[model samples]
Structure formats: structure tokens, C-alpha cells
Target: MRVTFGRHKHPRFETYTLHNGIDIDAPLDAPVNAVHDGTVAFADQFLGYGLMVILDHGGKNHTLYAHLAEARVQPGQHVSAGDVLGTVGASSVEGPGVYFELRSQGKPQDPLEWLAREGH
Candidate 1:
């Protein structure tokens, strides 16, 4: 997994503060998968996120996959880890890659930490 951008504060943007997620570089149309078992909470265009999919993993844990060329899942759909949620698309502010975010209790968490913990 090539991470183009990571979770951190950006001093360059006047209004933008922190980047709550990581941007993984992938070829256009590459399949993007669910990080864990969850139910699709949302699957549609979301502001600058473009075509995105938000997964609800219960316990207020959620995972968001943005910049998708196509969404394979739908709202309320159950998905296991590694299930195809969508395909990578050039819809991000950073270019052609997937913007991934992990949240707990509605707060952003470091996805790299979680991925490392999962041995990814």
C-alpha cells in the first residue's frame, strides 16, 4: 500500500487544519475493499470525497473509502473484510488514489495504526 498522504496537521492551508485520513496510491479502476466486517452506511457522492462509501462496523466504529470510480456496495449492505466496496478513481484533491479514513465514536483515528495492528 503506497500512502501518498497521511494523518497530520497541515500548516499550508489557511483554513484547513488536519488531515484526518490517509491517501493510498492506486491505479485507476483498482478495486478498493472493506477493511473490516461492516454494514454500508452510505454509498454516494459526498462533497469533495466524490463517490464514497462509509461502512459502519458497530460500536460507533466506521471506515470511509473515498474517490471511487464505482461503488459496488449500497447503503445497509453487509460486507466482510476484503469485500469490494468500489474502485479507485481520480476524484481526490491529491489526484488518483483512495482517501481512507478510520473513525471511532465519530472521531478520526490513525488508519496506519489500525492497519499495522491488523498486520497489514
Candidate 2:
């Protein structure tokens, strides 16, 4: 998995702003899966995110998947971890990749810290 961009203050044009998510570079149409079991909160085109899916895992924890070519889930749908949510698309501000974010109580958190490491 190639992580093109990480959660940080990225320089854009003349100013720098916090990038609340991480961008994982992938081939077009690559499967995008849910990181955890959750109910789909939203599934549609949203601003610069292009086609996106937001999953509410309860307890104020949520995960977002952006830059999708198409969404396979619908709002209010329950999805389990590893379920395919969509396919990677070239709709991101960077390029062809899936932009993922984890939020707790509406605040973005580093996904790397929450994701399981290989072999663990």
C-alpha cells in the first residue's frame, strides 16, 4: 500500500492547512473496504471528496472513504469490517487513491495510529 499523503498540515498554493485524512495510492477501480463494522451514515458525492461513504461506528466514532468511483453501500446500511464500500477513483485532489479518515466525536484522528500493523 502506497500512502501518498498523511494527516498533516499540507502546503497548498500559498497557504498550509491541516489534512485531516490520509491518501492511499491505488489503481483505478481497486476495492475500498470498511475498516470496521458500522452503519453507513452517508453515501454520495460530497464537495471535493467526489463520491464518498461515511460510516458511523457508534460511540461517536466514524470512518470516511472518499474518491470512490462508485459506492456499493447505502445510507443506514450496516456494514462489517472488510466489506467493500466502493472502488478507488481518480477524483481526489492528489490523484488516483482512496482518502480515508477516522473521526471521534467529530474530530479527525491519525488513522495509522488506529490501524493494525502487519502480522499483529
Q: Give per-candidate clash totals.
A: 0, 0
Q: Give residue 119's lDDT in candidate 2 (0 to 100).
A: 19
**Per-residue lDDT of candidate 2, residues 50-116 (tens digit):** 9999999999999999999999999999999899999999997667999888899999887877785
lDDT per residue for candidate 1 within 44-101, as digits (tens), equals: 9989899999999999999999999999999999999999999999987667899999
Which residue pairs overlap in candidate 1's backbone? Answer: none
User: What's the C-alpha lDDT at position 101 in model 2?
Assistant: 88
TM-score of each: 0.88, 0.86
Q: After superposition, how far is residue 113 of candidate 2 from its true place, in Å?
A: 0.4
- Tell how far residue 97 is off in model 1, in angstroms: 0.3
Q: Against the true structure, candidate 1 has what lDDT?
A: 0.88
Q: Which residue segments of model 2 deviate by more than 4 Å?
A: 1-14, 117-120
